[model samples]
Target chain A: MKKRITEPVKKPAVWIGFGVLFTLVTPWYFPAGSWSPLFWGIPYWALIIIAVSLALSIFITWVVLCQWDTGADETEDER
Target chain B: MNMELAFGGWSGILVLGLYGGLMLAVGLFAFLRHRGVRESLDEYYLGGRGLGAMVLFFTFFATQYSGNTVVGYPPTAYRLGYQYLVSVPFFIMIIMVYLFFAPRLYSLGRRFSLLTPVDWIDLRFRSKRVSVLAAILMLYGLGNYLLEQFVAIGQGVSGLTGGTIPYQVGVIFFIVIMVAYSWLGGMRSVAYTDTIQGLALLFGVFTLLIGSLIYLGGLPSAAATMAANAPQKLGAPTGTALTTWFCLLVLVGIGAAIYPHAFQRIFSARSERTLKRSFIRMAYMPFLTAGVVFMVGIIGISAFPDLTTAQSEQLVGMLANALANQNAFFYWAMVLLFGGVIAAIVSTADSVLLTFSSIISHDLYGRYVAPDASEYRKILVGKLVGVAAVVVLVLIAWYPPGTLYQIFVLKFEVLIQTAPALILGLYWRRLNTQAVFVGMLAGTILAAAFTFAGYRPLGVFSGLWGLSLNLLLCVGGSLLFGASPAQRERAEEIIAFPPSAAAARAV
Candidate 1:
């Protein structure tokens, strides 16, 4: 089987998703109300950001893996 | 500085010593194994350009996310509030910038055996002066960058350890290990240790988050405290702050993507596919590392509000103190966190040192100074220079004239100047060698001027202002002079390789 080399696409949805991820990681959406939920003093928004950030990592890993497979297959076919 | 309280007493020392020893062992092992065949420059400098995905990813990760991500970023978030969340995406956007150039660069690197950015310049422009100047600029930027990491190591170690080791001792200890390893394994040692260090850093951060959340009352309580006390930190960037965020997005996006060490990794990839895949994944790391630190800083705003810059800089230190007082589990977590901080710093330094030496070995001494020099001689020169660089950098760190952040940006300003020659030479057929040379020089000067002048163009970084001017000159000058028929043909040939290859690969 010939290997494939995947060319990068300028996908609008991917770009938009990136923009959303950027915005989400920022602290812009924290509401004005504060209910004290003390888990030894760490904050809810902080934890939420960390969780979201971790999810972002997993998502990135998925995306990169897809790019790798496609690109590798394409490149090998060229050879 | 809480010298007595900082080290976590015996545990901290043991951890630091163990980590340092491991790094040294990696370095020495690489040196001894590869030293016999030092004649092979590719093997010595780039690990024969055969890194797998995991090593490449972790090495790249360490290059971008460092101890600075841990110790410095939180205080930035604490001070700027939620507005500084710009740091996260700015990092992500750097990978986005990579998408524009890295694939093509990788293809070209393989074609010409390009080891440094200067090699690319040599191929593209075929101008001796242009290649030489780019090499010098890279060396300067990389040297200062490595120095910045050294300084951070000192500050991060003492700060995280609550001053147990003091700045000088901490900086020396890690830098020595970094130099030893880089001299031995070159890129291989750096990448291997980066994997270990990156893991330690991740573990440290997650533990801190878990502990901080349990101790602090979670984000809701922290947000309540922030909103009640100082809402501005959590508020959106407005006026100067908003402009600054936009500025940060552009400056860091371009500047960091163009960092010399980063470009080296682009060359180090096993294949174009590996490079592209790594970058795609890199885009999301900000959330994991920077976002985590930013959160810790935000919580600190409430937990220990009203601390000075120096005090806030020691936010992790103060938290560790408080955490230790809480329980044994918290104490161990704090210890791990400090170790992570040091590990991150060392990882960054080792990578920087590796690239710094490669530039000297491959570009300066190897290319112009002595094209016929054996790989052993080249590696030896690079290593000696690297060790000397560390020594001088340690002294400067002991007396860092300005704020660490200022010195940090100064390094980027110089590094970012190469963007025109690097990114533009890829797509622009009419890019003149003279234009590239002038544009890079002009861009660098303007960046420095803007930085030194403290001229924030509408709250954006001076470097961005310089880059804008640089790009204008490059594009405009290229049009005026135009590409020679030969230049145009060469560019067409290079650019045409990919799509055709992709088509061929697809078929």
Candidate 2:
């Protein structure tokens, strides 16, 4: 039984992306009393960071979906 | 508080009775359609792999976001104010965590005919000990999670009825409806009920928001009230609260993604495309569910003002009472909102019960105890376990118990213990199976120890603290005492670039 990952296991890229987005999302990075960059009344910081988080989520989903093999023969019967 | 009814009297009871009857009819219908043909475990548990994107999405949505978000979170927001805005993103982060395992797990689930997440653990580790332990953790966590929903059910029933129904009666009525559908219909029944509940929840939330704004004023006014009375509530995150926010994001994100019920949904997805689309849409739901609850709590700051912790849990009750006093429209909307909250909890409990039964029947009894058990016997065991689990959870709920958040976090901590095995198996070939076993065990121990001791590191969740140490052992121990060449070759074979025999067999 060969160990298999249907998609390339790209760890570093995913982790770094998560790290950056996480840093941006938290309020600690901002100085006290300063309004974050504005997106519909939210701080600019929150909107920007959530955008990054949003992007990361999409990328991870894409990466996961890519692993699907529509052509792979059924393994249940073979086993 | 034998308060007068604005729209209630029987409008509320009629609406609720209709909703409950409809849920049962759907479950009974699905059971009749699928019961005879469900000769295989896959047909029953995964709906024969035919669930469309919409059904799959709503089912997954119902499982992940529950009554807690609707009935519980506002109180936290009411108490803590803007500081709890973190709840919104934390919900989003759960989807992000799913990205880590969704692609690979879904593919493997389809390949191996996997029934539960523990089956995946069995495939990855090939260790009975690891698989059994994971199942136990799942069962324990799920039992606790189900109990929390029961508590919410009681609260929601009483709140909605204005105490027209007692708390115990409320819990029993809904639990009976839930068990009937779930026992008879499996995942299909659960998903259909979820669809109804999800729609009701969406309608109720928007209505509450509109009604609240019309009567209580908008967020800015509420913010002003917080700014005046409890300045810290409106202040920026700092000290322990900020650190806890980040910890919550990671803890909940990973913990939620790996939930047995959510993982089962990965198997239930009709296709990779369906799963992908569901999540893409899900990225915005925090805005609707969590975001609305956050708004509700924010309004509470001004509306009720200075509620004690126990009193704070009654935010929804307080708001509904106030709304009912206002006028007829507000009264009706409040009743619907309370009904939706109870429905949401029932839907979540059904999912948890389904997964719990699957773990017992498929993972433990079928795989280890009786590998050749017939599909009928397996389904029977699963259903029986589901009923038994509900019985125990109801008893636990009956006793005065822990805070909603505490029970919720405890579920995550237990589930996260399995991460090293599932996530690492995808990428780390040299993650020695014994090392994976030891790491997961140690991680769970540390998490439980810290949790029981009232030790929350830096005010972060105790589970992440355990996970930190767990990941270290898995990676560090693997490097220090490397696997034999044969084992390394086996590892490479198990985690290679393309689907292989070992990977296909994964749970």
Candidate 3:
């Protein structure tokens, strides 16, 4: 059985998605010092950044599970 | 920050002693379980490459979130306010950066039985100059890093015991214990202790947050306090602060993911599946550790308003004190929290020391000085040298080097210079070895000079500035001159090995 080999570096979509998420995680796109309309006692912008960070984590999980396959472990099993 | 907990005294000393004893016991356990730990570099340094998912995850956790994360990050959050929320995502960014290289790095590590990051460098470049230069740079950075942990451990110990155990005594006590365990079982001891330290750190931070919320106030109250007086703390970062936020994310993301100790843990995993699972678990840990501590700092704002910058350094200690005074349970818990803080520092120091010795045993002495020496001899030399380094670093930490302190601060800057060679060499076949040597040298020189001069153009860090130049030279020189055909084919044979071979192995 030929393992479905994948590397995260080879996937353009993965990079593009990460690029977007990384941008969102930085809070540079938010209005400077404009943290009004707080929710759950968190500044609105802080909340947004936290949510994006969560999304980044979830995206990382997806990439690790789906996009990382090198058959190294299957080879180890063979050994 | 010089800090002392209110509940620090005999109980603190007692807990510290117990934690040290527990670590030694763990080391003994690892030694008894694996009698051949000292017989091979692979068994000693990489735990024979058989670490399960949970141990790998905890070791990674221990690397990222250390005693500093518990005792250091809260004060930072207290000062920076919502702007410091960047700490949460910055840690997550580490995992994000890992995704770009670790998948392939893990496979290569397994294929080649790579023991240290320098091993990978030597394997790829096959140039003594490049490999030795990388090795020296790693050793220097790791030495400074261990020095830092030693200082933290001393301060943590003294502060927790309220000077019952003097700073020098506390540092020496832990150093002896740390070296003993690390000598006994090698990476196995370090990883097992890290699991324990990681748990203790988590427990410490969560209890502090819970105690603060229960006794002091919540985010809503803290927000109101910020609104009334320090609205800037409640606002999103702008201008220079925004630049700092962005710089931290990038520097920490790449620098930390490639930390020599953290990078080496990749080769220790039992299998690629275990490594992947550990990383997936690590991706979300910042929320539980960094995120919780960050909240505790914000809550401190409401509890102790109008604290000066110097006074704010004692914020966590003060908060723990207030909680301890309220109830007996919190009093004991606070003592354990301080003890945990000290243990966490030792854990981080142990990992750095382990990696430091491995580079000595595997890369420097074993490979060059005595290629025919027994594994036992190599391990012995590495241990003795590592202990000598500790003694020197302890002296430096105690009687401070009065000048040229910026040279010691070259830890991250110097380590990151190796990133281009380590990460790029994995993929780019045409990467010139001469260019790698020149780039790493120039990058370290530029970073150290800029840092010594306190020069960060455009609010960007000196390390990133050095990295930018290093990347330019690495890429430009490769595209212009490229590697020799033989080197290119070697790279291909190592990295681009055929999938058909892998498929055959799977069968």
Top candidate on TM-score is 3
lDDT of 2: 0.76
lDDT to native, each model: 0.73, 0.76, 0.90
* Alpha-carbon lDDT of model 1: 0.73
Task: Tell me the tens digit of each residue's lDDT in model 3 across B1-507.
Answer: 467765788999899989999999999999999999999999999999999999999999888888888878888888889999999999999998898889889999988889999999999999999999999999999999998999999988888888888899999999999999999999999999999988888888889999998999999999998989988998888888999999999999999999999999999999989999999999999999999999999999989988998898888888888998998999988988887788788888999999999999889998899989999999999998999999999999998878987666789899999999999998888999999999999999999989999998999999999999898888898999999999987787777743455345446
lDDT of 3 at B328: 91
CAPRI-style class, candidate 2: acceptable
> What local lDDT does model 2 show for residue B328?
80
For model 1 chain B, give the 10-residue run with minimal summed lDDT. B1-10
Give the per-residue lDDT of model 2 (tens digit) for B296-369: 87887777777888888877777777777788877778788767877888899889888888888899889988
Q: What is the full ranking by TM-score, best candidate first?
A: 3, 2, 1
C-alpha lDDT (0 to 100) for residue B318 of candidate 3 = 89
The DockQ figures for the candidates are 0.21, 0.28, 0.83
TM-score of chain A of each: 0.64, 0.52, 0.92
The Cα error of candidate 3 at residue B317, in Å, is: 0.8
Assess the local accuracy of residue B219 in candidate 1 as a C-alpha lDDT between 0 and 100: 65
The candidate that wins on lDDT is 3
